[model samples]
Target: MARIKVRARAVDMLGRQQIAGIPTAVHELFKNAHDAYADNVRVDYFRADELFILRDDGIGMTLEDFEGRWLTLGTESKVGANDPGKRVWTGPRKATVRAITGEKGIGRLAIAAIGPQVLALTRSIRPEGLGSLVVSLIQWGLFEVPGLDLEAIEVPVVELQGDALPDLEVVTGLADRIRANISHLGDQIPADMRQRLLSELDMADFDPEAIYSQIDGPKLAGDNFGTHFFIRPTNPVLADDIEQSDDAGSEATPLEKMLLGFGNTMMPQSGEPPISAQFWDHREDGISRDLIGGAAFFTPAEFDSADHHIEGEFDEFGQFTGSVSVYGQPARQHTIVWPDSSGRPTECGPFRLRFAYLQGLLKDSRVPPDEWARLSGKLNKIGGLYVYRDNIRILPYGNSDFDFVGIERRRTKSAQDWFFSYRRIFGAVELTHARNSNLVEKAGREGFRANRAYREMTSMLENFFERLAIDFFRPTSQFGSEFNSMKAEINQEAKLLAKRATKTKERQGEFKTELDTFFTSIEKGHPTREAERIRAMTEERLSAVATIKSPEAAADALLNAEADARRAVAALEKSITVIKC
Candidate 1:
């Protein structure tokens, strides 16, 4: 019989290559904390030192649990594989139980995607008493060497008594081991390549003890047992992943963009445990600042300024029961029953959705001009429909560049009639792993897999928008009323102008008769030089008035004015008809 063997490179492939980017790597860590019933998690980055640390105040692991579960790849402990009825309690008190967000058990490997080496320290709180602290040093570079089996790469694990964390000497010893592991590969590779890899370690100035003192001394004081990670990114690309801006024009770093929605993704329902997350950036000047300080992507003002709003939940029957508010009107109960082609209960399950339609134009909004301008600027940068599962956001959905629901493509078909565009609406589709197990996220954390459940969810969203367009957006729009008012005003002005033109023609006739009488009187009275000049000028004016009163010219002018007004009204009517169709 032949047995299967795993290579050392499998760790590199699963950790560094499986995860998509830095943001996803951080998200996996946060999910792990959530599953442990953590109330708070803090992420810190030291730009000058290229050091990254994450601390969570959760129920940490014991040395036994660390060895049996944490070190075992693809562990099924969280999934209850052996005992189907087993329930995992989240907090140390066992008061709250949460469905585990992770099932594949490969999330621990995501740490390698951010850095080449990691130091993990954890202290467990069991029902009997506090357990000893478990320390582990993971050298990811060891897995990269050729001709090495997975079991041959040894990870150093230590058990310390009574919250005794690693000191400077312990950290230096681990660093030396990493250097030795890389140098040991010299027999398999060239000598110059070995020197280059050794130089990249830069371990002379590596200091984890100072970082621990700066963080743990004040935070983890007095009976605080949790997990902390100290990571040193030796690769320049990995360091730039956290510090550089996501776009050329953006001032916000990639880390800042990811943390902006921390703890703000969903409003907690009754009995739901709340989690808080924060990010601290240590600048080169030795000053630290919180990147996301209670800032929300959407403000109340933006919600209030929305022209249309729909919020409700979809039942398992593929029916939506909710209220729809249009243009500041009172919200009314609205329901939509989406017909499923499969003729079965929806596989997507039950979820809640909240959407706000913004016109993104000042003239269309009732908000104050200054406030609207500021909100518009924000909407332009962070406008899209977002997805959150168990109050945690799924990435690449709400980003400015991602059009997950196909709104942009739909708008291209009927751009004018379709009132909703990707940038003009803000939405959130809330899901839970317990109810929406079929709508699974991809391994890379980019988006949901293109499964039947995902397709059904997106199709339902599109149907909702279509219903909104036909029932509310088109009917309540100001275009029809404003166009009608304009047409009426133009017709009235045209009639008044024709009346004035006719009155002017009658006045010219009367004035001509009076002037002719005056000229005759001047000719009979005297033949002085001034009188002769006045009579000649009066005759010239009277002759011009006679030409103005000609039947052909007067009739032509009235007819032309009426024709122009009729054409204008007809054009407006045609436009309205097209819009309605």
Candidate 2:
């Protein structure tokens, strides 16, 4: 029997309603551990490799918790609650206990997602006398008996097996200790599977002196707080095979580089927290810095049945971002905040669309419903196949990490895919409804409101990233430098852009005037002024102007056509004059 050690029975997934892999089921457990005050957590795999364990030193389980709550499936996590988003795990008198982040009982299913069977063993470490509580695996597996109804509707679950897996008590060895304590298990992870657990426990402890000695000759004290996820796995049945970094010569991991770049960026104040960055560009000129926020899942997919929202005011720094997801289509699925036996969530809405696309829009002008509908129409057809759409035409953006958006394959893998899965996924479309809505009378009708909204969002995102970058890169300075005026540079560029926009508007107006004259000037013009060929006329005029990138040039082409029409009229006038003579 392959023996792997893991903290088990931390919670029961059967108690909650889910049918999936262990990772999906245990999402809640890890969430609680992270949210809890606990700094460390351990996930252990035992004898069968499938026997899972999750242990956290935050706080142990209590009698009421074990019997009534922890074992209860689908508990009401937030009711009349402040921050109904989460639960509060405060030790009596706040005696330095770990904070907990779990809310939904469904998190127990995350374990099921990770593997087939789990042996739960949890205890609370709080005020002196909150005696350790013991709950059995069988008890958890049977927490929800068949045919029980929740307040919402009939519980869809058909059967709840309390004794879902074999029960065993294991003690001793590297795997066992790690199964017990969450902290030590982190470093012990190996790059690829096939190694024994106890064989590498010693490698987990910090090698501070060795690490510090290599940092620019000697390490600075401040950067000591960081977590490292080593890429190594030994023992196939007991461990997982993971991709390893062969760059032993480098002192830092690639993930660390991505993070450090954010910290040392200019205008760092803007890159903190919800503001953490995705990328930074600090040109060696040491004068300019630009940082972009974390890459949010920009889901452009929408369906006719899909109803999603984009709402959030830009913070003080002017960064606006979020998602647009759609699930009403035949293919897409909705995310379930609360699990149901059907494995599909009815409450969490069917579709979402996220984008910084709105960032540019936020700065543009308020977008009208018509324009949004137009974009949604073109975009919804993309499904999992495409990402970017420009000017109502589907644009093939690069593929997403999760392979969800496939350019070549175009297949929807599953409801839960790692490449596209987000712990917190939200998309925003700037609900820009028309500002200066009446300006359409002067500017022309078809695109005024829509154009303004587009310009606004585009402008906001550009400056937003610029500001964030400046803040992030502010810390790293030359030995001597003088205060520079970046805003002045920005102002100058803005003026040029405005001038160009005005010219674009003028050219569009003139293009309409020229096109009408062009067809009239043709001797072969339809003898009748019929309305039937309006569409064809438009096609011909547009085709003529297609090669012209400059709006001004297009307008000139139309004007030339008008000039010909006048000449035709003049020739007829000249003929009558000669006849009278």
Candidate 3:
């Protein structure tokens, strides 16, 4: 009997090809740290050296655990046979247990997306005492070699004495093994490619002294048990992932945007422990900043400028119980029945939705013009309903290009009736790993898979938006019935004013002509100087009343005013008709 075997290239398929990009790769690592109960994770990039390092003070893995779990593909340690009771605990402290964010064992392979080579170091804490530091160097390029079997690769794992980390000699030895593999594949590959591979494996030039100096630093000294990954010659694509800022005209990298919805940045949840993340630039003239400490995109002014605020949770029965607050109006509690055609309990678990809606141009916003411009720019950049699971943001949801909730599609269908746009919403749909197990994300981190649960969830969300439109947006909109009434009033007033102006012009012309005749007759009679002076005075007094140069000009002015008024009335009527239809 023949048995199936996975080629060495399968690792590449599960890693670099599977993950979305650099940001998502970093996100996966962050999730891993979170599952390990890390309170903080610091990612540092050395621009000059093209090196990336991520350090976390989590409960690190022992040698046996690393071999059994980290090295094993598709391990079920986190899944625990799909039983929630047996799922991995986030921390050793049973008092505060967080649902594990990482279930697929291949998440660790995401490191391959970052770079070709990675040096992983970890020290575990045991019930007896501190475990020996375990270190492994993985050359992902080896996995990509054609015709190579998965078992053909040899990854050396070294356990250092006490709490000691691996030294340069140890790293050099591991790198030598990578060089040996490349040398073995020399005849099968091009000379130039082989030379390039050999050049990249120049571990003699690699110096991690700066990185080791941080081992006993403030962040890792106290715990002395955590995980550290040092990756060299990071993927060049990362350098291009720059976020152009509209406000300050500055630039931010993917690392800066990583912690946007982490911890209490968006909305704080009770009993959830705060996780701090930072990005350090170790290059000369580089600036190190706290990733999660930046101000939120939606400020108080932004929230206040919103036309409507909707926040609530869906129960297991698919009933939404929440409050809708139209700006300047008292909050009203409302319950919306889910439009479930299945007539059964939803497979999509209950999730919370919080969103602030803003109308285009912010015509009713009280914020100052300059401030509003800045806020509008932010909305255009970061707007869209974001989905968060356990306070961690799911990618492609809040992105300006990603229309995960079909908002843009709905708007395109009935543009006039669909008052909502993806650009006008600052929202979040919160879910938990345990409850939203069925709503699985795609392997590429693009979005949720189009499963029944996902369909139900999106259907519910769309229904809620429809209800919001009917209950709040349509009634308070400036393009509603009240607007039509105001336009009608203005049109009537304009028509009356135009008629009165025309009549007044005629009367003035008549008076001017009579005065001109009287003045001319007096001048022809050759009256005394006093009579001439009196006539001139009367003419001057009457001259002020003659506004229109001619009857035709006066008629043209009235015609234009009437035409404008008529056009305005027609537009208003058409709009009203559409709304009614």
Candidate 4:
């Protein structure tokens, strides 16, 4: 036999070794489906095997696009920068459009972890003025895979064969196996199962290609062209004895696999109010902000309970472990005050932690209200959570320490209270995640620019603020006594001055006469006397202005001179119908 050798394959983003087990890859597929404007997608199980199926009423794909869209890995249909001004894909009405999320494009290789089967079918969907083939799209053939002994076997990186779609029979058998696989999963399904599946299975509500129902308001909208996903584990399609099972675990079907879904759409921007918080005089005593537009789901038949995690599902690195942030406000813009090498804040540099308040908004089981209030002062805010929305994206600008928002002052001043409150989060997630100054700088610039362009930059900062407030800050001790002293100082100043007033009638009368003479002279073209009087008056007021030390002094002089004038207005207000609390 001739000697042959092969080089080792490198790991891409969707490599099986990169993800914990199976769920991560499925997540990629669902992401793709959303980009395609799929209304509802289901990964069903039958015959103890997994059958991955995603259907969208959006523009269907043709054979030409199968290689470009489905067959390609690391594709993102929604990868462009977010825009509030451009309402094109803001809600959900594109069938053939794509999104940007996955970077490696290696999700194809991950299919091995699901099963040995794969297929994709597609058709073209055109816009109203355009013809049928404007943009080619594809429907993935019912993808199926055989059980493989993956325990000791490292996944070999390989590409899918040819540009053809899978057969319809494969899809039918896959659907059948979806049912069979569910039975195989039996009781195990309930542990990882979620209640959200039943609704996701209702495909009509989720097509991404069709524009959805209505536009609610600014910072809120209704999903029209729907795109969503539902998935679950399956029973044993392979003979139990012949199965390539791992000592640490046995095989599971795709339908039996954990599921996640996402969707996007455009809404009429008519009701959207201009974005700003200066008008928010006080807290909003409402139920929710209704900002985020997606859901996390587990089949009721699978998990039975809504527990947030499944233990053994992650790799030893604990990367695939579940984490969720519910309640409070949605992700907010981050602040990176530092400039890049060019010394511009939005250009490049290290990272900076953006800060915001988002507590009492989330309905999660977590949060301690009293403690959060205490943490608020440290936050220099109230009733808000501080967290990072997206992983800070860093752009290299030489090797210098160009950290913009990574300073301890930034974290301590805006986020310290919250960070400390959640200090022990699985050890030190806050400290580790926020330490990347390089990333923060780039992301902040991007966000600042996006904000100006009316973009909703993604970040996990709300949850970050909440966790920090809960674990890091003491309920009554986020800040020092000095902060309290400042509040007291303001109150003292207000009280001292409220009872006093300004304006002495005699002095006022003289000043008024001088002003009238000066203005009258100017109109009569007599500048000399007017100019002199103005000079004298200005010279006299200087002394008064200098002698004034505090508002109280100003108040005292005016009150003594005009005490009688105050009574009229005060009495009228007091006599009014009601006072709002």
Question: Could you give the C-alpha RMSD of every candidate to the true structure, in order shown?
Answer: 15.4, 26.5, 14.5, 24.2
For candidate 4, the per-residue lDDT at 465 reads: 33
For candidate 1, what's the RMSD? 15.4
Candidate 4: lDDT of 39?
44
For model 4, residues 416-504, the per-residue Cα lDDT tens digits are 35432221111101111222222232211112233311111122223333433343233354332332343355456545444342434
- Residue pairs with colliding backbones in model 1 are none
How many residue pairs clash in model 1? 0
Better of 3 and 4 by TM-score: 3
Q: In model 2, where do residues sit more than 4 Å from their true spots?
A: 1-21, 45-51, 77-81, 84-89, 92-102, 126-128, 139-313, 316-581
User: 393 in model 4: Cα distance from truth in Å?
Assistant: 14
Q: TM-scores across all candidates? A: 0.75, 0.29, 0.75, 0.32
30-118 per-residue lDDT for model 1 (tens digits): 87887777887888887787787888888889988888998888777777522335656556656455556777765688888777778
Compared with the true structure, the alpha-carbon lDDT of candidate 3 equals 0.70
Residue-wise C-alpha lDDT for candidate 2, range 192-216, written one tens digit per residue: 3113323333323323234324222
Q: Order of all candidates by lDDT, from best down to worst? A: 3, 1, 2, 4
Q: Which residue pairs overlap in candidate 3's backbone?
A: none
Q: Which is better, 2 or 4, measured by lDDT?
A: 2
lDDT of each: 0.69, 0.31, 0.70, 0.30
In model 3, which runs have C-alpha deviations exceeding 4 angstroms? 87-95, 184-193, 214-223, 243-259, 268-274, 282-284, 290-292, 296-307, 368-370, 413-416, 476-581
What is candidate 2's CA lDDT for residue 496?
Answer: 69
TM-score of 2: 0.29
